[model samples]
Target: MKINVKLFATFRIGRGKIVYLDYYEGMTVKNIIDELGIKKEEIAIIIVGPHDGTPEKMLTFKVEPNMTVHLFPPVAGG
Candidate 1:
């Protein structure tokens, strides 16, 4: 399965803004993050296809083929 992953904020340091990953069956959002070497605690929000929600729920989400995954880091303000 081909999955499109979009990284936001600090998450795009070494990794590019958009990444294409070839994943296997039953791959969860957390699996993708781990593959990219990103820590779960560093992710604040996750959007999988049409479903968007907290990291807690999204991390465990099983991704489908050709689905786009958006990951955002915590935002800091003055």
Candidate 2:
């Protein structure tokens, strides 16, 4: 299965480009994060299939084959 990953804000700055990741059918957001080597500090927001997603739960959010995962950095502003 392949998932579309979009990196935003500082996450993009560090990663250089968005990515398409391939994994087994049962893979979750945490699995992708581990495979991509994304640091915990670099991630602020994670949205999967129109709702808030959790990274620590591992399989909490079940991703469909070819689903788009959005990654955003922590907002910093006055």
TM-score of each: 0.93, 0.77
lDDT of predicted model 1: 0.91
Q: Write the per-residue lDDT of candidate 1 for residues 17-57, one digit (tens) a residue.
A: 99999978999999999999998898888999789987788
lDDT (Cα, tens digit) per residue for candidate 2, span 1-77: 68988887766665656888885777878777777678656677788877774455433576888888887767888
Model number with the top lDDT: 1
Question: Per-residue error at 17 for model 1, in Å?
Answer: 0.7
Poorly placed runs, candidate 1 (over 4 Å): none
Most accurate candidate by TM-score: 1
Candidate 2, superposed: residue stretches over 4 Å from native: 53-59
Provide backbone clash counts, one per model. Answer: 0, 0
| Collision pairs in model 1 | none
